[model samples]
Target: MWLTGRSIALIAAAAVSLALAALVGIPALLYVTGLCAGLVAVAVVLAVLARPRLVLTRTVTPAIVEPDEPVEVVLDVGVVSGVPVVAGHWRDRLPSTVLGTATGTVPVTGEPRARVEYVVTGRRRGSHELGPFSVSVGDAFGLVQRSLVAGGRDRFIVLPRRHSLDVRVGPAGATDGATRLHPTSGLGQDDVIARPYLPGDALKRWHWKATAHHGEPMVRQEESELRPTVLVVLDADPRVHDHAGFEWSVSAAASVVAHYGGRGFDVDLATGAQQVSLESGHGLQDALVVLALAEPDSSPLIIPARERTTFVMTGSLDSTSAARLLQAVPSRDTIAFVARGTSEDAHGALAAAGWHVVVRDSNEDLEAAWAAATGVPA
Candidate 1:
């Protein structure tokens, strides 16, 4: 409960009226003072009654989206008891870091229900709460105001957007021991199970016997082929990078994983301590989300496995660490994305050590960096 500017002015007028009536002995001034006081009392009571009657409900379309995409938020406000509500103001509470403060006016105009809609962009990748809508109502006379917090919150996730890669890739590295144990069976082998041919099935792998028996082309469901693994190591040391640099490194790592995974190359994602190999029963989206929310890795980078191709994204790396990284993968198979601040000698040593090196300055685009490092157009 609070007094509006109009309420303050009215009270001041009443005080003046009383003063004039007492000093000049004017009886009409007393009547004027009484009227003003009565109106003020009525305004205050109306404001109190109007506040509790407001209802707010928040809804969002496409609650899950990629970062930097726009999202629509709708706020439905209605009055209980179908009563006429005066024009009011409203503001939706959101995290400043996520979305800036959003505020506007609520015009009832004799309607029992009203809707307020706004747009906000998901600027980062993560799960975030949208709002607890707040509304402020004042009396028609604007003599008193009441503020109420009314709506529940909504949760949404801004997933990391995957980048497209147009470059050609080489054969995958060796399969893990687990894959070796479950090698794909051949068509004529006893373990062979024939299934109806699906699109993209190789014609050469079709079983002629099964096709003749079933009158439809059937393909052997050979166990999935084991592809060479591409290990991706992301260095998230906070001491080495600012927030922007860390995000870039994350996006770079995610892009590499996605590029390799899409190309049928077994992809493995690793941070300072966490390692997720998609070939080993890990979900792709889950891996991307982990990368999206990855914090600076306090522990140093330790390669989890040997692979045909290794992509390393880091803020900074010393010569010793660079040398160790080169030895982690096959010769000329490591590609390094080094954020600015790494020494020239480190870059030179990594390159001389047969690692493809890309040195990126602040805010460098990932596609451009990749093109520069691999000598391929994005």
Candidate 2:
């Protein structure tokens, strides 16, 4: 409990009155001092008892959003048991970058429960937590106040906004219409032919009508091709990129993933030590969430030597690191988006190694940078 200015002033006046009563032997002054003391005691007791038996729960609508979108946070405050407080204060804890503060009052009447709604805008892309809510209650006279923690925290992720690119970066690995031949593997819409059944084949693959026609156990033959795969490598080492540089890299990487993944290309997202190959449907959203929360790591880039087309987005790159990348991806068929502040030698090394390199300044437009990198008209 904390004393308000009024409470402090009353206590001081009481002490002065008591001192005067002792000096002048005035009974009225003693009564005035006693009255002030009694009021303070009552206020203290009320403040102590005014701790509201409150249950608080916080929920955020659309927990995952892109930057600049507003998220509504609703705090439900219900009184379990206690005298209805005349007034109470509440404040929500939020990230410093998120706009707006949650501050309001609990009214006297209406329902035993109240909902406080506040909209918070995400200023940047990343994961954020919205808090342990704070509640304060005081006596009717507002002389003493007591505060308590009411609610647990909730997590929200602000994903990077996907930018539109006029120039199409086609799926990697193979042409759009190309198909790969496979032994009648899994059942799918692609099965086109039936041949004599092979040993150890599952009964499910046996074509019953085709077997009777061929006078033998015939199995279905299906032809399916692996989808073109695109690898997105993000360099999140804080030593190279400051906050702005890192954000740009993240945005660029997200754009690349969204672009090809939308075209039915298999997307592989890698940052720091984490790597995941995305499936169809909700897979891209799941990958973006991980990318939004990715932080800097001290490890160097570890690009696999696979033949899939690779895209590297980094704040800075040294020659040694570039050489290591060349060693892993010897085809040098990689596309590199090197952000500002990287050494010229690093760019030179990657370029000399046959990689298509895009050098971007701090303020360059993403589409224009990409156009210049891929020799496409924006």
Model 2 worst lDDT window (10 residues)? 173-182
Off by over 4 Å in 1: 45-55, 78-87, 94-101, 109-113, 124-129, 150-155, 159-163, 170-225, 263-266, 274-283, 299-308, 320-333, 340-355, 372-378
Question: Candidate 2 on 142-178: residue-level lDDT in tens?
Answer: 7777777765789788998778764334223222121
Clashes of each: 4, 0
RMSD for each model, in Å, please?
A: 7.3, 9.6
* Per-residue accuracy of model 1 over 1-378 as CA lDDT, tens digit each: 888888788889999999999999998999889888889998766655554566777888777777777788888887563223464788888875476547899865566778888888766887777778878766667777767776588977777666775443322231222221224434443455565442223456677898789775565654453224567888776766778788888888888787766544456787876877776334776777778668886775656444346678877777765665565544355677887778787889887865677789757777778777645566
TM-score of 2: 0.77
Instruction: Point to the candidate with the largest lDDT.
Output: 2
Predicted model with the maximum TM-score: 2
Taken over the whole model, the C-alpha lDDT of each candidate is 0.68, 0.70
